[model samples]
Target: MSGLIALLDDVAAISKVAAASIDDVAGQAVKASAKAAGAVIDDAAVTPKYVNGFDASRELPIVMRIARGSIFNKVVILLPIALLLSAFAPWLISPLLMIGGAYLCFEGAEKVWHALNPGDGHDSEAHIQGEGGGVSLEESRVAGAVKTDFILSAEIMTIALSAIPVADPLWMKALILLVVAVLITAAVYGFVALVVKADDFGLGLARRGGGMAALGRGIVRFMPGFMKVLTIVGTAAMVWVGGNIVIHGMHELGMHQPYQWIKDTAAAAALAVPQVAGLVNWAVTAFFDGIFGIILGFILIPIATKVINPLIGALRGLFGKTEKAGH
Candidate 1:
């Protein structure tokens, strides 16, 4: 009887420790996921456009496919790579993060430039109406979305990895990142599914003819403006997060002038309005970060479009020719 009681007590203690570990993992996952908000928001905002012209019935399926790809990207591809980096070349993380940040700034700045110069016609109606069969178009869109998701997923995983403590056990870090990956993927794609189907839901409601119908009609009317607002917010987030990353990376790399200047300016602003000092400081910091991001983005745009893009295209072309010749 004494032996059995001791065994039971041991089991109980083990269970308590397991439960506590699980709780800790969950808490850390949420905190780490929050750090990647910029990438997450951009993922959510950009995904809906992929399903925009698709058939209503296909929207959810398309989202599911992309979500699956995203999960694979995060778990099978990015997770292992992230772990290897954490274990070995940890110093590479900050530079890679800065590269990702620069990409974000370039993307956001390109959008802003396009918005200002709508005559560029890069995303004009004609581009959408290009000669392609519906199935092919769908495939192309899905592939494009998946490719974009891979970049955003890399950013998210890196940011999450960075947020984890260096002293954590490998298993704990893996568990925290895995949880973050699953939760973020579900949140982003789930929200995307809702956004894509909302119009259909609204249309159905509008057809029913009642108070519900009016509400449905209102939804239909609201979605366009809502999407525009979402895009603007996402772009702003990308710039802000990107700029912040680069600034911090610079500080880490021992060039502290920009970061110190921004800090001093924010501190000065905060002192001027001590009542809402924290809020003022954050806003001022974000504003300057966003401006820096915009400027960096603009600088990168021409290089990316003129040099990087052409080089990539040539490489792809050469690879395609090599495969053809081999066959």
Candidate 2:
């Protein structure tokens, strides 16, 4: 009857609304994910090293375990933290983001410093290769990688949360962040899995002994160089994104001098090259951002190495003593 028709119409309207909300979530998720590209690239670039020297059979399994841990870090740990920040302490987001940005800058600059002065012996490659005596090497590597991923995931989630519109409903923000978490974790770790196994794939192709074999040999030869390039790119991205975030955050906090100076300088550079003005502007901006990041990172290096590291070691020692006493 008429009443049945009205009920059906109401249901249809609700369905339409739900569909629109889902679409919004998807769109926002993709946009937010793109905002965290620097961290994503670094994640992909950093992960493969953890599986290095492992048997081919173990590579994929290791990656899967790391990926699972990354998901847990993002979903179970960071997601709720992000939601709580959005709901309660929205004002703190900018400062926390700047802190993360400073970290990126410091990391990138330290790498540059090490590259320029290779005798430092502080490289992670050496640490990763050095055998730890207590636990299985594989377990130690996995634990280290998961710890690293937690930091990167915190950066990713925070960046994504900042990218979402503040006016959006809480549920909408949650949905967008959830989607971003799942998609980004899958993408980074999946690419890492491929990178880790590429050598084996190349070897298999070489064994076939044909035209395809040549391609496989090429892949095998190309992988090391490609990884180096990826690392360099990831490092640069971290510097750029981190520096940019700090600058923007400062601007938001009413310290606009640096941001304005950069903008003006980039505009001048763009005007000098009218044919590729946009490209010129971006290049100039990125250049200055990188420089700023390097400087800030250099400043932080001594503090981190001398102060923060020792403090952390002391705390860990204290906790170990406490636990033993309790036992």
Candidate 3:
């Protein structure tokens, strides 16, 4: 009887530890997700465009396919790479993160440049319209979107990985990353699904006579403006987050001029509004970081277009020929 009681006590203790570990994983996952908010918002904002012009019935299905591809990108591809880095090459994370950050900055700035200059072969209306191309177009769009998602997912995973404590056990780190991957994928794609389907939902309600009909009409009217707002917010977030990442990376590498200057400026701003000091500090910091991001992004655009892009294309061509020769 005494032995049985001791066994039960031991089991209970193990259960407690397991519960605690699960809690820790959940907490870290949420924290890491928040850290990647810019990428998350951009992912959600950008995904809807892929489904544009599709029939209402096809929109959800297309979203599902993209979501599946995103899941595969994050879990099957990125998670392993992230874990290996964490386990062996942790020092590389910050540099890789900065690269991702620069990409985000470039993307945001390019959008702004295009917006200001319009119709320089960058027309937004060029996306395939009228739903006539069928499965090939759908497949092509999904493939392209998935490819874009891979880059964003890389950023999300790297940011999440960086947010985690280095002293965490390997298994715990793995668990946290796994949770981050699943959570971010679900949240981003889930929002995309809703955004794409919202008009149809609103139309459905509009057909029914009641207060719901008015609400439905209101939703229909609201969607376009809401989409614009979402895009603006996503762009702003990308630059701010990207700038912050690069600044932090530079600080880590002991080049702290802009980071320190930005900090001092933010502190000065915060002093004027003690009641909302935290908000003021953050706003000031984001403002400067965004300015830095814009400058860096503009600098990178010409180099990326005139140099890096052509080089990448040539390398890809070379690799393709080599593979063909081997086969």
Tens digit of per-residue lDDT, candidate 2, span 12-79: 99999999999989999999999898889989988899988877788898899999999999999999
lDDT of each: 0.91, 0.91, 0.91
Worst 10 residues of 1 by lDDT: 122-131
- Over 24-60, each residue of candidate 3 has an lDDT whose tens digit, in order, gives 9999999999999989998888889998867889999
lDDT of 1 by residue, 136-185 (tens): 98888778888889999999999999999988889999999999999999
Q: For candidate 3, report its TM-score.
A: 0.95
Clash pairs detected, candidate 1: none
Q: Which candidate model has the greater TM-score, 1 or 3?
A: 3
**What stretches of model 2 exceed 4 Å from their correct place?**
124-127, 130-135, 272-275
Worst lDDT 10-window in candidate 2:
126-135
TM-scores of the candidates are: 0.94, 0.94, 0.95
Q: How far does residue 312 in candidate 2 sit from its true spot (Å)?
A: 1.3
Quote model 1's TM-score: 0.94
In candidate 3, what residue range of length 10 has the lowest lDDT sum?
123-132
Q: How far is candidate 3 from the true structure (C-alpha RMSD, Å)?
A: 2.0
